[model samples]
Target: MEQPFQFKQFLIHQDQCAMKIGTDGVLIGAWTSINENPVSILDIGAGTGVLSLMLAQRCMAEAIDALEIDDKAYEQCVRNFENSSWGDRLFCYHASLEEFADEIDDEYDLIISNPPFYSPSLVSTALQKGENSMSDARKKARFQDAMPFKHLIESVAKLLSKNGRFSVVVPFSEEEQFIKLASESNLFPLRILRVKGSPSSEIKRSLMEFTFSNSKIQSSELIIETTRHLYTEDYINLTKDFYLKM
Candidate 1:
């Protein structure tokens, strides 16, 4: 059965995808900077192609390309892309980041990723609690070994255009290590957003953006909910246009 996620502008068919659409993808997709009027964009590990679709709807970027490694997710992402209004301008490549980077010599003006966060050796709380059943696709979607930060940063260094921008979302605790790895590849932080579930809750996720230059970093915080199922005004404002009921 294909469970479809309803968005304001487009519906995403994601039953075949192990990693369904979640707040992290939406947060990074909506929060990533796009002011430069990029002519081409790339979505790394695009799950259901939501980020590419959102950017296509939000900007005039003529080319929105996505890369996915998982067999099922890649097919679903292609289906989602072709079903969208921007199908003529959108395309999906069924390949790993390394494979895509190795084959393609073109640079992207904007590249975005909501990469797998947990290391292959670690199990997430959701997995331990039985909330998410671990599978090959899910593991490949969330494991560090599947797409290491070092590999991702190095690819960005080579694939991103000189004036391009790159963005991603990962666990807040990994922020320091992720930035350090990026700096080694000469990709400096441009903006950082630390996200919390509630005002009193500990920081949960970090949404980061980078570029080739060592520009002044813009840092900030985002609280998604003031209480369970109740969103903050800022959160509402940031994602209102895309979420059906936001």
Candidate 2:
């Protein structure tokens, strides 16, 4: 069995999940704005419910809901949530974003996601016969076609409260396109944090926070390491609360 990822206040068992615990999820969970003191928070595509668990530990949100589409992932997510210290506050729903958005009338005060990031060409190749045979679980977890940017943005717009803020981490290359899609739904970017593996490496990811109303954008950059396995001060400071050895 895969060991659970031990955080300062919680543990996440991701043995059944297609995508294991990753830096992107941790970054979004820790970096998401809780300044509004949200009473309810939603985590879309919750794999092992790690993001929801993280939020529950970080804030006093009474309702921390997660939505997962994959069967195994959903089951693991629920199990992980139940095992956490804040089980009362964490709940997992096994449903696609579209179905959940259409059925649920309640709105969330805060939303977070580490969405799938495979490129279109790669997704196309995966679909072709005799190509690199990716498993169904991993396909759904990593391919954008499983939960397209337009669909995600539209669903989030409908499910978010008027003052709610949505935070997500996506490929830096998709930042421009994703923002355009979000703007179509009136979700303006409030902050953008570009992340690089090292100071010399190219930006690899974009952590973005959005809201209903437009405002002056707060843009910044983060380099995770100064050298191999050597974390940078900014990365450590930002994640010190959740990471055990920070």
| Candidate whose lDDT is highest | 2
What lDDT would candidate 1 get against the real structure?
0.90
Instruction: State every prediction's TM-score relative to the real structure.
Output: 0.95, 0.95
> Across residues 27-105, which tens digit of lDDT does each residue of candidate 1 receive?
9989998899999999998989999999998899989999998888999999998899999989999888888899999
Weakest lDDT window of 10 consecutive positions for candidate 1:
118-127
> Which pairs clash (backbone N, Cα, C closer than 3 Å) in model 1?
none
Model 2, stretches more than 4 Å misplaced?
121-133
Estimate, for each residue in 88-119, the C-alpha lDDT of model 2 and write its tens digit.
99889999999999999999999999988876
Q: CA shift at 83, candidate 2, in angstroms?
A: 1.0
